[model samples]
Target: MSTTPRIEVAAVADALYGKWKEERLAGRALASDPRLQTIPGQSMDEHRERVLEQLGLLVEAGAIQRAFPKHLGGSDNHGGNIAGFQELVFADPSMQIKSGVQWGLFGAAILHLGTEHHHNTWLPDVMSLKLPGAFAMTEIGHGSDVASVGTTATYDPETEEFVIHTPFKGAWKEFLGNAALHGQAAVVFAQLITNGVNHGVHAFMVPIRTPDGQMMPGIGSEDDGVKGGLNGIDNGRLHFTNVRIPRTNLLNRYGDVAADGTYSSHIESPGRRFFTMIGTLVQGRVSLDGAAVNAMKGALAIALRYGSERRQFSGADGKEVVLLDYGHYQRRLLPRLAETYAMQFADHKLLETFDEVFSGANDTDENREDLETLAAALKPLSTWAALDTLQEAREATGGAGFIAKNRLTGWRADLDIYVTFEGDNNVLLQLVGKRLLTEYAEQFKDGDVAAIAKVVAGQIGEGAARFGLRQMGQSIADLGKVARSVEGVRDPETQQALLADRVQTMVAQIAM
Candidate 1:
């Protein structure tokens, strides 16, 4: 492939890229730090403690402080922060995710969704790891469907508070990363009801632990315990029953309820308001996408390195075949190598778009929507790619890969959840397809038959060219043989045009 894109194992210029360097350096520090290593038996209690200790090391190093406000001791280079945050997957996926719980999910919810008052009250402690928290949004039965979560925050004008309740068992938030341990609080999501009208799911900073460190009243929690991997995080479930807090507890950027139980907001459209509130934290998806891409690169690097060095067969005396030289091995790896490259290129573009939307560089509704869709589209692809790459790399290593000492198997096992945990791959892709469909339908919203006709005619013309209706045979047909076509594809512009054209053609066909 002439037009090859390169994925970064160590990227430059991205805000997250610089943070990756810091993480690399920090990872080195934890290399000898005993607390960073996973325990053999891997019980929840034992693992959570080790991770907490490791968090202290990370915080002391000021690693997670990179993308926040400088006044709060953060570097505030939003994009670069995530770039580095993702590289932690190399050292340990557990560390990467646990740190994400603290910073990416928990901290981001506060940073993006909360007001300055909320920031002043909560950020410093949270940023310093003095107050670890959970992003309690994913209910057990409503993981992807946030709109219909069974929890509620009913406004009480009598006390100027919102009483949070998990009205149904299904509303008990589950699989929360920090809930079982380390977290002292959570940014809980619940249906916002004021004056008897539901305003949809909204977030609230609810304390789960007291100052002396006890689980708060009416807050029930249970550890999710161990299974496949990423055991370092204390995945858990939380349920709220009559959890009452001040009305200000609501992270009311998009909407707010008054002491009189009256509701009003800058965004009048409830759907847009909800999306706007949620879109503020799209960085979680962006960062995850980048990290997943990095994981793929790491697997490829280790696999490619070992492949080059640890040869199998011989074409000559005492010469084992360099794995890359074998067409079979290259066929197995090279296309994925190309795909990883595409994901990397696409993710960088998406992250840039995310920064543009979130960092106030060009924060428009359209840009925010674009960023969210891009994140949803690519995160699943990259994460699934990482898991596959890791598994393939592990398999390539044969017996050596099976042993935990090589790290690939361990990484592979840990990454297994990536496919399902973050918004689930199929559901996420469905969202992407819907977005594309929405965009397509808008083109015909005016009932413009001419426009529809124009598109159909263009698609038919393109299809004809592709299948040789326009030419006697084919435009480049028999220019030579396979070798001739290969040579033509070798030109970067040719490859890029062909690639871009294929996407357009496919979409047009699907739309029709």
Candidate 2:
């Protein structure tokens, strides 16, 4: 065996993880926070309370305030904020997720989509955990599709307030963290109607609870009890019935209403305006992508450590072989390890791109679109990989991995819903596929006859080559020609080209 194919492990790990990310990892407050430590045999209710307390601890340590404007008591470090946020999985998935719901989804919605008035009025309390809030976007009828939510916020010029209402049971905001217990307010998403003209979905600062933790007028909620996992999050559903809030409660960054109840927006196209509003909060997906990658790495670390210590069958010299030294064990873990590294690298790039857009350094329509597409693409891959890697790690560790003390199964179960959180995996990938097709079409739209012909011919040739290779592979396999089959597809370039061609062909067919 060749022993000359390795690089410096420490240096490689540092580079792959990114320097800022390494700093955040080294400086994690959760590492020393006694309150955030997991307790053995803790009840779900106890764990939920503990995790909520951990949010206050995080706020006290200023962990959740980094992404806010520097002028308003924050470091204004967007990328660093996400870098630190992702590392919380090392503490507990429930704590990480609940904190994410409070800060990333709820607080971030107001910060990004709301104007300065919303920020100055609400964000200080939000940052301090003095005002817990829910991101009321997902409804029973519309989790993946935000624009079709049945909740309505009708602007009333009579009182200069918006009347928010959930028309039916299915329109209730479902699976919302903080809505069950701690939330006093919510960045509620609803269709904005003014003067009989219904605008698309918009976020409003709606009060759900009073100072003494009682539900406000026209607000109803139910606790989602004893979920399969992530019970440390007090998930719940909320319904509104003719709830009226000040007209200024509307987070009007993208659109606004006049005192006369006239709706207006700088973005003329309703579709573009809606997308732009939604795109501003893509950091939730970006953070989830990195957090899922962190969970995968955590599981792999536990399994690898256990495997390196636990001896399996006897070796040639009558000494037992360590599980990690076996070829089968290596095969199972190494490929996934390599994949986690790849995802980490891609996630780092995604975080950087998100910061660039959000920091106003490269804020543009195209840049925002690119950031959103990158988030949609990478989130699905990392979350699905996390679940798969955790399962494999659990299996690799045998009985030890299944033990609750080891944390693998618990982490796996908690992460299971990540594939659906922020955005569902399949729906996100469909979004990515649509973006790909749209970009592909854009390339052909401005082309003259000659250029259009050239592109179409090229795509067809690529598809044909892919089809021919598959046919050749089939024929070789049918004749038992193993060597010829290997030769035909052995080149990495050939394999990649074939895969790309297949995907392109599929997208084209779907476009047609």
| Most accurate candidate by TM-score | 2
Q: Which stretches of candidate 2 lie above 4 Å from their native place? A: 1-6, 26-29, 460-512
What pairs collide in candidate 2? none
Q: Write down the lDDT that model 1 would get.
A: 0.79
What root-mean-square deviation over C-alphas does model 1 reach? 4.1
For model 1, how does the per-residue alpha-carbon lDDT over 342-461 read when each residue is reduced to its tens digit? Answer: 787787788678767656898897887788888889989898889888889887777877778677777888888887775788898998888987787787888889998876666665
Assess every candidate by TM-score: 0.89, 0.90
How many backbone clashes does every candidate have? 9, 0
- Model 2 C-alpha lDDT per residue in residues 248-294, reported as the tens digit of each score: 99999999999899998999999999888888888889989988998
User: Model 2 Cα displacement at 365 (Å)?
Assistant: 1.8
